[model samples]
Target chain A: MTGAPRRTIAIVGGGASGVILAAHLMKVSGGNVRASVIERDPRIGRGIAYSTELPEHRLNVAASRMSAFTEDPSHLLSWFRNKYPEARDEPGRFLQRREYGQYLADVFAAAAASASGSGGLVHIKAECASIVQVPGGLELRLSNGTSLASQIAILATGHDPGPHPDRGFASAGASVPPIDCDRRVVILGSGLSMIDAWLTLQARGHRGEIVAVSRRGLLPLPHGEHRNPIKLDRADIPFGTELSYFVRWFSDLIDEREAAGGDWRDVIDGIRPFNQQIWRDWPISAKRRFLSHAKAWWDVHRHRIAPDVHARAHEAIADGKLRLIAGKVSDIADRGNRTADLVVRLRRSGDRIALQDVSVLDCTGIIRDPATGSNPLISSLITAGMARTDPLRIGLDVTPDCAIVNFRGEPSDRLFAIGPLTRGTFFEIDAVPEIREQCQRLAVGLVG
Target chain B: MLTKKGKYGLKALVHLSRLPAGQLAFVGDIARANNIPKKFLDAILAELRNAGFVQSRKGKEGGYRLARSPSEIKVGHIVRVLDGPLAPIPCASRTRYEPCDDCDEATCQVRHMMLEVRHAIAEVLDNRSLAEMRDTTNDDLDLPQLQQA
Candidate 1:
């Protein structure tokens, strides 16, 4: 508790980013910073990722790495024990993401209640339609026809599953189109999103045939215990090299490590800290090459899921209820029928697999193009020339410190972004460990 | 086969074709808007500029704009500019023909078959203009998925 809080930071979404940032800001500023979390969704902490009611949907990361505070490593496990004492609280335990959501909301509440300074949390249940810079700060227009003023605005609007065409196809597809529990369902993209759909369907007692189609037919690897991240000097890395050369170097390193009685996971975990730096050092051409050629491979290796989830997917495959195809859905035809027809073109064999009279679920991926994403706030930011998509269209363009860059490539002072929205700038972000550290750093900067 | 470069070029052209006449768009904006690589798009736009498809200006407001009316530019023409010929084989190409090292010029079965393949591809592509491509919505593409069934 310090002097009277004069500044209020308006966080546009009440997801993990908004809550975590609010907590960090309060902690760093000694409760001298004020923030209002504006979330259109009813829940204050769930966001899109953690809103699931299904017990089967758990966090991909373990409890040990899911702490909200950088200073407290055991915070998540402690909170989990208090909230659900019957459940196991092992460090490696993967708790339900919904519980994590509850933990976040509770943390923010506790911080706000105990703060002696004017720092408090106010959750506004309205969508931020747009944000514009004012003379001294920023103005936010909400969907409820109300406006908000704050010293700074952070766009914490989390993952969008692309445009409206992708409606009913989000990975957390609870309210999707009606489909028989025993009918065939074809899911596009065999990545995390596909795994999510598989988990959701299995939770719903779905016993039908599920065909997963992807460019490479790759699945996410599972998490394990033995984590030995290697330390590397800056000079040792082939910084600013062509993508192929970097890939070759990494491949050789992996081979050498595996030959020396080590696991490939060690190599991936070893390079985790340097992933963003390596990406930053590359030229636009090299970055493009990585995205086009190595992104899928990298994604599977880096973003591993829970071991139980991996086992269930494989079990389904063994039971012949799930099918994996190394192909792409070239077209989805809806003849005003209940089921859409998908013509999947196999990549290797070049054979067309005609999936007839099956429900089509597009779990292709996250919102790659932020400018055209489903969120009106993002498009409004772009239209107002206050923000722009990154060169890759992966997310909103941001400076390394998470400042939103305008159309002319100028980073804003009062306007900022975090969470998955800043993925283009911080490639290794979106996970708890990375985002938590980022929030702490950003909170320090804002408070200072 | 349309290379990724060609797809990107088409996407860029489609984006440009949608812009109001004489209105300019920076290469970076176009690249981000259409999910195209910046350097690759820069090169493609330069080729398009040289082919009289787009015009570039200099200065702060400098960027690119469609030179000819989108309707005046055919899809086949842009593909040829960005991705060589529409024909499967060089010998079958009408504008940029080159003899294949293995195939005969006359009465070659492969060339004859490829000539028909080239004609079939050109018949559709040459008829469609950039304007048509621009007008084709994602929903319109969905219709063919049913027609082929």
Candidate 2:
């Protein structure tokens, strides 16, 4: 350890990633570090994903896969068994998002309790408005007119759910309440958020027809019992391969599996552990191609919903209550009577189809670029030249260790980022499994 | 979530659900009608039969038949038998209850949401019988269709 006083690390955003990072830091720091978590919300752990008021929004991943600690993979599962004894034998279950949030809060609480006498963990219920580099540390200015100086700062603000991308649709102002139950609705994205909106509407007793439109309009696949534990060694992956070649290779592999009566999921799941490596090995152009061409397809297959949820979604489609349209919404116009029509260009024919009397819901997931976002903290950092967006513009630029890369192309030693803020560098940073591993590594690096 | 087995099984069961009560449908015919591979459909039907959703007989004129009336069998029940549980998460599952290991069941935010998801799913799948979904044409809309490009 350094021959200095205890180092203070300020983590902005007390979400899942921040909580997990603090817990790991407490375990490894050995009273050498004091951690202060700055959050806008009153409570920590329930980020945007888990803080939903609706109960119908379930986690896409199963229970067994959502452990906050990679070392104790069964931490969540064991907790579940202890709480719900009946489910002790069933490991392949998905829990509620809030339950996961509570678990995180509990884990953080335990960690904080243990570190009470040491450097200790402090929770500051305030938003970090800006961070400035100072001598031997950084100063974090909070929204509550307070400031804190720390030896290191970790940006874990997570993703921002920005407004709708289509200016015309957003201007239509269809999101207002007293929603017409009979009006036709068009959702702009076919991801999990789209499904959430559909479920929300259903819960609200909406009998209207819904048309979910996306560039690909590919809905998420259903989660089924995984029979095969297919293991792929590094040699099996086409590392350093071009994007086109890798796609062909992967397609052929899926074809081979299907031919042998095996599910394609086995292959996708098998390669999950190695995605970061493959993604890292890919050339810049290859990564771009992947983001442009294969992202939608990969999303649907990789992010599967529970079987019953799948059934309900399919049933809605089957009943003609919901429709999946593969297209891009070109424009939306309000038609004077609180109704609007969207001009959608079909993906295949490029023919414009006018969807009539429909309200549009923006479910295109969270914003990727923090620089252009409404988040004051992110905007402040970008403006101060303390952080810069990656070339892809998907997220902030960060080194593999999550050190913030400045505009001068230098990685900051005292400043770091984790979670969704580092998506541009690590493609799979949003999910619990990936984030937990990243947090563990970052904690070790920071403490060491 | 519908597994390939569950989907194929549901399709076959729906096909049977549409048939005259007590009449049998051959595995080949069901597979051909639904675009499911014959071998795959055979295994799926075998599972459905083992779960007591269907009864099969061998030899000429022998085929598979629903064990009960189509209206009596809920899609949710079939899905649970073929797939596993209707609940998105284990803790919210009624038929297969399993507590998550990480949080307080009473205070977990995720369980509350999942419970609602399970209820929504159960409302749709459990309340609607196979007979009710038998005539729905949207079932095959996901199948590949020619599009003008």
Best by TM-score: 1
lDDT, candidates in the order shown:
0.80, 0.80
In terms of lDDT, the poorest run of 10 residues in model 1 chain A is: A166-175
For candidate 1, the C-alpha RMSD (Å) to the true structure equals 18.9
Alpha-carbon RMSD of each model = 18.9, 20.9
Q: Candidate 2: which docking quality band?
A: incorrect
The alpha-carbon lDDT assigned to residue B23 of candidate 1 equals 96
Residues B37-141 of candidate 2: C-alpha lDDT, one tens digit per residue: 999888888867655578899999899998777776767767765766566777775324578888899999988997677668766876677888886567455
- Overall local distance difference test of candidate 1: 0.80
lDDT digits (tens) for residues B1-58 of candidate 1: 6788889999998998888899999999999998888999999988777655788999
How do all models score by TM-score? Answer: 0.73, 0.71
Off by over 4 Å in 2: A1-4, A85-89, A164-180, A334-340, B1-149
CAPRI-style class, candidate 1: incorrect
TM-score of chain A of each: 0.95, 0.93
Candidate 1 segments exceeding 4 Å error: A1-5, A162-178, A335-338, B1-149
Tens digits of lDDT, candidate 2, A347-382: 999999998877767677664668877678887888
